[model samples]
Target chain A: MKVNELVQKLELEVLCEGESFFSDIDGCFAGDLLSLAMSNVRAGNVWITVQTNMNILGIASLTEASCTIVANGMNIPDAVIEKAKDENICLLRSEKGMYELCLSVGELI
Target chain B: MNSFKVQYTIDGEDFSVAGEASRKLKKVLQSLGVDPQIIRKATVAMYEGEINMVIHADGGVIDAEITPEKIHLFLRDKGPGIPDIALAMTEGFSTASDNVRELGFGAGMGLPNMEKYTDYMNIITEIGVGTTIEMIVNTSLS
Candidate 1:
């Protein structure tokens, strides 16, 4: 499924405007640890995490993940949003917790 | 085999730019038409090394050599070196402070994950001097 579809289905807030919203997502990986996420997440997967820092953007780009959904309505940093825009990474925010977000993403993909 | 080399200086104090080297290397590998799987492995391994340099080494130098057969990464850091290679290699063993942990890292999975993704890895370290890590990811599986 595409990132825009997931956003519509999950009712996630688009944090940054990017081309990846049309990118296809394979699955979902939920984790806060950067290394673990990088090591485990499959390319084209949607990363569900509570991490709001800029490193998440770096990881997203490195892993080539389709998008990042910050769970639990956390306030993503402005710098992170800007970087997301610059990198063309789809950044989204969700009111649901990690588990719910993962479930929704899993069902979609 | 044709070879290309690139070097990056990691700033230990800057968490924001920790994975820049790995990201750039990924692009280079992509442009060179390396296999995506091999590129992913190299990028992940190097990224973990880059993060380790920032979190533990207070900065370091990364030298990457890309060839037809493999991608080689040499990371050298001037920080408090690991006292026990075995212990440090163990998963879930971390010495990072609380502040570092707050950034969602320091789970002690960095080195282990790097080893997992790469075909070969080696670490040379001294107590107070520093640590140097060499990792290689083969482009083609044997």
Candidate 2:
């Protein structure tokens, strides 16, 4: 499914809609460990993590993930949000936990 | 053949800028027409090393030498060196504090991930003195 369609279907809160929001999403990979996620997540995968730090943005951009869903309603610092905008990374947030979001994203993509 | 070089001194106290060097290196590799997968492997490796510098070493200097055949990363730090390289190399081993964990790092995956993503990696460290790491990623110029 497309990034926008998946976001709509899952009812994700759009913290920032980057250019990739209009791109296609192929799979879902959920992990909070930056290094592992960096290694495992592929291009166009929607990464599910509770990490709201700046490194997540770097990982998201490096891996070129479709979008990163910060689950569990984690509070993302403004600095991180600004970094996301500057990098043009598609970052989303969800009230739901990682497991639930993964299921939803898995089904859609 | 002449190689492209990029260097950055990571601010050990700053979390936001830890991976800046890797990001720049990735862009340089991209502009030079490096392979996508090669770029991914090189950047990931470089980023992990860069973060490691900021976290464990209190910041360090990272130099990237980019050539058609490969990319070499040399990281140097004056932070307390590793006492047990073997234990540190094991997965799920980290000396980082609880604060670092909340940021989604310090899972003990950085070093292993560096080795995993690089073609060659070497470390020279002395406790209370400093540590230096060298990693290389082979690329396809053709």
Q: Which prediction has the highest TM-score against the true structure?
A: 1
Give me the overall lDDT of model 1. Answer: 0.89
DockQ (C-alpha based) per candidate is 0.89, 0.81
Best of the candidates, DockQ: 1
Lowest lDDT 10-residue stretch of candidate 2 chain B: B133-142
Docking class of 1: high
TM-scores, one per candidate: 0.97, 0.95
True-contact fraction per candidate equals 0.85, 0.77
Across B8-120, the per-residue lDDT of candidate 2 in tens digits comes to 88899988778878888888888998889999999888888888888888998988898767888899999999999989999999998899887888999999999998889
Best by lDDT: 1
Encode model 1's per-residue lDDT on A23-109: one tens digit a residue.
788878899998889988888888889999989998899887888889999988798898888888888899999988777677678
Clashing pairs in model 1? none
Q: Point out where model 2 deviates above 4 Å.
A: none
